[model samples]
Target chain A: MPKNTLGEHLRQQGMSRRSFLKFCSLLASGMALSPALVPRIAQALEATRRPSVIWLSFQECTGCTESLTRSHTPTVEGLIFDAISLDYHHTLQAASGHAAEAAREEAMKENFGQYILVVDGSIPLDNPGFSTIAGISNLDMLKETAKGAAAIVAVGTCAAFGGLPKANPNPTGAVPVSDIITDKPIINVSGCPPIPVVITGVLAHILTFGGLPELDDLGRPAAFYGQSIHDRCYRRPFYEKGLFAETFDDEGAKKGWCLYKLGCKGPVTFNACATTKWNEGTSFPIESGHGCIGCSEPDFWDFGGFYEALSRPTGQTGKNAVYGVAAGTAVGAAVWAMNRAKKEEAVRGHEKLTMDELNREGEES
Target chain B: MTSTEFLLWVKGTGFTLAIAVFAAGIVLRLAEIWSLGRKPDLAEAKGNANTAGVRTIFNRFIPDKGIWDRSAFIIIAAWFFHVGLFVVIFFFVPHILLIDSIIGLQWPGLPTPIVDAFAVITMVGLLAMLFHRITQPVKKYLSTFEDYLVWAVTFLPLLTGYLAYHRLLFSPDMLLAMHILSVELLLVLLPFTKLSHSFTFLLARWYNGAISGFRGVQS
Candidate 1:
C-alpha cells in the first residue's frame, strides 16, 4: 500500500518528467513563489506519498464541486486531484449508503491523524435533523471525522464563512467548519464557489510543504487573497480618471469606464478573479459589465443591495454623519457668535488716537 | 493594531473627525473675518465696491511691475507652489473621489501621470518656499512656530502618498493609513493656523482691491 510514490505513479500514468516539472513551475508561480522554488516543489511533490483525503458535503448546492469538475479539461490540476487517494466523496464515489460509510471509516482508520479532510458548505447546529448523512447528523460526523484529520480544506465560502445558509437570520443555524473544529489547521478557499486553480494550488502547497500555506486574517491563502480586485482590474484607469458608469447602459458603461458608481464592490473585495479570470481565463464579473457583489467577503449576502455603491453607507453611518455635522455646526455658530461679540466689545473700547498721542504712547513704550 | 485595523480607523473615525473639525473651523473663521465689517469709507467712492471686490479676487494674483521684478523668484516659486497644490488637491482622482463622496458632486480628473508629476513638483516647490522663508532675513524674522507646523503637516501627506503609491515604506495598508492620517493632520490644523490663508487670502485680496478700486485705482 505504501510502495508507489507520486513520481512512480506519474511515470505509470505516462506523464513525462518535463511536463511534471512544468506543472510544478506553474504551481510555484501561481502560489506567488519565485521560479527558483520550482525544483524544490517538484522534488517535494515527487517523493510524496498519496495523501489520503476525505471529502464531506453538508448544506450546499454542490456548485463548488461543479466549479472544480467543470473548471478545466483534463489539465494537470485535475490529474493531481486524481492522484490523491480520495477515499470518500458522496457525489464522486460509486458506493451505496453502507459501502460509502464503510469506505470513509476504513480510510480514517488506516490513515489516522494523516488524512486531509475537505469540507464544502455549512453544518446546521440548531437542529441535527436539518442535514445528515446516513442518519448521522452533519455536526456529529464533522466532529468525529475532524479528530483524525491532519488539516482541513474549507473548500467554499459556505464551509469557510457559512455562506448563504449562514446569512442573516440563518434558519438552519449553520456554522462553518472552523467554527466547529478549532484543533485542525483550516485553510479557507473562499469565493462564491472558489476558483479551481486556487483549490488545486492550496492542495499542492499542502502536499509539497506538508503544512498549511500562509493565510490572511480570514484564514484564506495570502498568495491568492492578497490584493483587492480593483488593484488588478483593467478598467482601473477609468477609476483614476474619475470616469464612472452612473447607470448600467450609460455612455460611460459602453466606454468601459469604472463601474464604481454602479455599485461595483471591486474596490473592497479581495480575490484573484481579475488576474486569473474564469472559464479557462475568460472574463470575470467586472469584465462582463456587471459589478462585483463581494461574494468572497464574509456575510456578503447582507452588505446592502448588490447594486448599491460601497461608499454608500448602509444606514447607520449616514445618520451618524448627519448628527455629527449638525452638532459641529451648532458648536461652531456658538463659538463664532461669542468671538464676534468679544471683538465688537474690543472695537467699542478703542479710543481715537492722533499722531501726537501715538508718538507719546510710542515714546512711553 | 494591525495595519488593516489602523487603516480602517483612519478611513472611518479619523476621517470623520477631520471632516467635522475642518468644516466647523472654516465656518467659525469665516464668520470671524466677515463679522469684522469694514468701517464705511467717508471719502467719495470713485468705483463700485462689488465689482472692485470681485476684480480684486483675481487681480491680487499678479503684482505691480516693480514689485514683480523685485520679487520675481518669490512670485514664480509661489505660483508653482499654489498651482501645484491646486492640481494635486482637486485634480488627483483619489482626492476628487473623496470630494465627490462628501459633496455629491463629481468632476473629471487629469491623467494619473500628470497628477503624479505635479505632486513631485509641489513637494519641491514647497521645500524651496520653506527654505526661502527660513534663510531670508526679513522672512525668517517674521516666521513663527506655526509656519513650521503648517509646513510639516502639508509635506507629510505628499511624502506618504508617494510612498504608498510606489509601495515603498511599509505594507500597503500601513502606507495608506499613514497617507490618510497625514491628510487628517493637515485638515485638523488648516482652520486654526495660517493655512486658513486658503480662505482668508480671498477675503484679504478682495478687501484690498475693493478699497483701492473705490478710489479709482486698479489695485
Candidate 2:
C-alpha cells in the first residue's frame, strides 16, 4: 500500500499531484514562508507519515470544530484534516465511552512523545463534577493526555485565553490550557472560534517543519498575529482622513466611512481576520459594516462596551480640557477688560499737543 | 519607555501641556499689547471708527499701487506662506484628529495628495520668506536672533511631519516624537515671539482702520 503516505493517500483519492502541490504552496504562503519554500513544503508533506492528532473537547460549544469542518467543501483545510490521522475526537469519532478512551490511551503509547495534542475549551478546576470525559474530570484527562505529547495546540479562545468561560464572574473556574500544562510548547489559535484556515496553517507548519512555528508574545503564530486589524483594514484610509460614521445606518455608514466613531476596536486588536478573513475570504466584520469585537485579544469581553468608541477618553482627559479652556478664557477676558479700561483712561487724559509745547520739549531734550 | 509608550505620552500629557501654555501665553501677550492703548483723536469725523475698523480688515488685503513695487515680494510671499500654513494646520488628517480629540468636534479632511501639495507649498513659501528677510536691506535691519529662532520653530513641525510620513531619518516613533516636540516648542514660543501675529494680525488691522476712519480720510 506504499505505507499509505500523504502523497499515496491523495493519489488514491484521485487528486492530481499538481493539486496537492498547489495546496502545499498555499499553506506555505499562509505561514509567511517564501515562495521558494513551496517545493520543499510539497516534498516534505508528501513523503511524511501522517502524525496522530488527539483533539480534546472540554467546556466548549464545539464551534471551533464546526468552523474547521463547515467553512468549505473539498478545500485545502479539509484536505489537511483528511491527511492527518485523528485518533481521538469525541464528536467526530464513532467510538463511544470506553472505546474512545482506549483509542486515546493507545495513540499516546503508540506515538509517545510524537503525537500532537489539539485542545478546544478551557479546563474547569473548581470541581471535578463540572465537566468529565467518561468518568475522568477535564483537568485530570488533560493532565494525563498532555504527558508524552510532543506539543499542544490550543485551538480556540477558551483553550488559549480562558475566553467566554473565564469572563467576569466566571462560575466554572475555567483556566486555559497554558495555565494547566506549562511544560508543553503550546500554540494558541485564538478567536471566539478561530478562523478555519488558521487552524490548518498551524497543523501544516508542524507537520512539514517537524517543529512549532515562531509565535508572538501571546503564543499565537506570528505570521497570523503580526499586524493589527487596523493596519491591514480596508477602512484604514477613512480613519486616517478623520471621516467616520456616527451611527449604524447613517449617511456616513452608507458611504462606507470609518466605523471608529461607532466604536471599532480595529486599531488595538491584532489578528489575521483582516487579511485571512472568514468563510473562505468572503468578508470580515468591518466589511459587513460592523466594528470588530476584538475576539482574538485577551480579556476582550471586559473592554467596557463593544459599541463604545475607543476615541472616548477613559480618565481625567475631559475634565482637564474643560479646565484648560475655562482658565484660558478667564485670563483672556480679564486682560481684555483691563486693556480697554486703560485705553479709555488714555482717551480721557488726552490733550492736543500744540507747536509751542513740541518746540519746548525738543529744545529741552 | 518603548516607542509606542513615548507616542502615548506625546498624545496625552504632552498635548495637554502644549495647549495650556499656548492658550495662557496668547492671552497674556494680547492683554499686554491691548493695555498700551493710544489717546483718542480730536481732529476726526468723516466715517465711523467701527465701520472703518471692519473695512480695514478687508482693505489692507490689497496693497496700494505706490508701495507695492518695494513691498510686493514680501507681501506675496507672506500671503502664500500664511495661506499654505492655514491649510496644512487645519486640514491635515492628523491635525484634525488632534483637534477632534481635544474639543470633541471633527470634520472631514482633504484628500492626501492635496494636503501633501499644500505642505510642500508651505515649506517652499516659508523658505522664500526667510530668504527675502535675510537678503533685503530693510527686512535685514528688522531681523533679529529671536526672529530666526521663531522661524526654525515654525519650520520644524512641517519638516519632521514630512520625514515621519515618508519614514525617513529615524524610526517611526522617534520621528513622530520629534514632530510633536517641535510643535510643542512652537506652541510655547508663540506668544513670546513674532508668531503672535497669528492672533494679532486681525486686531492690528482693526486698530489701523479705526484710527484712519476717525480722521475722516482713508489712509
Candidate 3:
C-alpha cells in the first residue's frame, strides 16, 4: 500500500476509497462546482506535500479546536490530522510549556511564508493586558508569528468577528485579527463553534489552490457563505402559508414550521448552514427546531438578544421587526380607510351635483 | 371515508382551489391592468394628461428598487416576508413532499432551520402588521375589510401551528385540527379576500414596474 496516500489512509481506517472520493465529489458539488473538479482536486492534493499548519489559541474556550479536532465531530479528527502536518498547536502538541513554544517558533522559522496560521480566538486590544501566549501579549505574539505566514485562517466567530467578546459594552475590548493584520490574506471561518467541514474545507481549498479561495465582501469564502440560511430552509413552505413556531417546542416546531418570527437571524445572515449543515449535512439549528442567531455574521450579538424570538427582542433589531409588523397593519388599514373615505366623499359630491343639475333640468323643462 | 383519507381529500381539494383562485386572481388583476386605460382620454397621467403615468407605484416592485427608504418598513419588510414566505412555501420541504406525493415531482427539501426561522419571522412581522392596521394613521386609511379578515385568517393557522407544536393554549390534536381548518379556510377565501394579495402582489408589482419603466417615471 502506498504510504501517506489519501486513498490508502482511507482504506487503513476500514473505509472504502470509493466512499471518500464520493464524499469529495459531494462536497464539491455542494459548493455548486462541477464533480469533474474532483480529479483535479485529488491530483493537487496527492502531489502536494503535507502543508505546515500552526493552530494558535488565544482568549477562547478551545471550542473551535475541539470542533475541528474531535473524533465524533464532523469532518472528524482523522481527516484533520491526516490532511495537515500540524507542526505546533497549543492543545494537540506533545511538547510542554517552553518546548511547545519553541516548537511553534521552530515551525514558523522552518515553514516561513509557507505555513497556514489558524488563529481560533479574539485578541484583546485593551492594553494587551488581558491575554498572553508564552508570557508575550497576544497582540505582540500574533504580529510576531503572523509576519511570515502565507495566509491566516481566523477560525470561529470570535477570531473572525470578535464573537461574544465584542458584544455590547465589550469589557476586554477584544478584536478580530483582521483589525490588526492588513498585509496577509485572511479568511473568516465563522460560527459559534465554527463548523468542522468549514475549517477543513478552507484547508482543503488552500492546499488544492495553493492560496485562499475567493472570499465574499466580508472575507468569508463565497463557496461557504454565499447564500442566506433563509434561502435553503425546509420549513419555508410553512412560512409562505404564514405558519410559524411562536414559542420553543411548539406544535409548529414539531411539524417544522418556519421560525422567522422567533428572532431567527437567517434572513439577514449569510451562511451555508442550511446547505452544508453541521453533523454531515444531516441537520442544523433550524432543522433541530431552534432559530438562527445570525452567528456567522459580523456583530451578530448586537443584532438583538440571543434566545429572544426575533419578534419580541427588546433591542432595536427586534423592536424594528415588531415595528415592521405594526406598520404593515397600520398602513394596510390606513389605505383602506382612505379608500373608503374617498368613496364616500365621491358619493356625496355626486349627490350634490345631481341635485343642482336636477334643479337646472327642472327649470329648463 | 376514514378521517385520515377524508382529511387528505379535503387537503387535496383545498390545494386545488388555492391554485385555481391563485390563477384566476392573476387573470383578473391582469385584466384590471389591461383595462386601466380602456378610454384614452380617461386614462391620462395624474400630472399631465398627455403623459401616461402608468409608473405610479407598481414600478417599485417587479425587478425591485433594491433598497428604499428606512421609514418604509411596512412595505419593505412586507415585501421580504411575502417574497420569502412564498419562496419557502412553494419550494420548501413539506410542500415538496406533498407535491411529490400528490403530483409526482420529488424535489429536494430546503435546509430545516432556515425555513423554520423564516416562518417565525413572517408571523412576527405579519402580526406586527396587524397591530399596525389597528394602530397607525396612514396605514389605517389604506386598510380594507378584506385586509382585516386577511390578517385574522392568516394568523389563526400560524397561532394554531404554534399551539399544536407546543400543545400550549390548546391540545396537540385540537390545535392540529384548528391549523388544518384555518389553512383550508384561508385557501377557500384566498381569491375572494384581500389575502389574494399573496398572488396579486406579484402581478401588481410587475405591472407598476413595467408601466412606470415605460413612462420613464421614477417608481
Best by TM-score: 1
Q: Residue-wise lDDT of candidate 3 within A191-223, one digit each (tens)?
A: 888767777778878866687888976788988
Q: Per-residue lDDT tens digits of candidate 1, residues A52-121?
A: 9999999999999998888763475777685688899999899969999999999999999999999999
Please report the candidate that would top DockQ against the real structure.
1
* Inter-residue clash pairs, candidate 2: none
DockQ of each: 0.34, 0.27, 0.03
Candidate 3, superposed: residue stretches over 4 Å from native: A1-32, A71-77, A309-365, B1-219
lDDT of candidates 1 onward, in order? 0.83, 0.81, 0.68
Native interface contact recovery, model 1: 0.14
- Expressed as tens digits, the lDDT of each residue in B1-219 for candidate 2 is 534345546655776777677876776776667666665666747779889999989888888887788788878887787888888888876576567666778777776567778878889988998998888888899889998998899999989987875557665545666787788789888977888988898899998898878877785
For model 2, state the Cα shift of residue B84 in Å: 2.1
Q: Mark the 10 consecutive residues where model 1 chain A has the least summed lDDT.
A: A311-320
What TM-scores do the predictions have?
A: 0.75, 0.63, 0.53
Alpha-carbon runs more than 4 Å astray in model 2: A1-23, A32-36, A46-196, A199-203, A210-246, A255-271, A292-318, A329-365, B2-7, B35-46, B63-68, B71-74, B92-109, B130-149, B159-189, B217-219
Give the i-RMS of model 3 in Å. Answer: 17.4
**What's the distance in Å from true for residue B165, model 3?**
26
Question: Candidate 2 - CAPRI tier?
Answer: acceptable
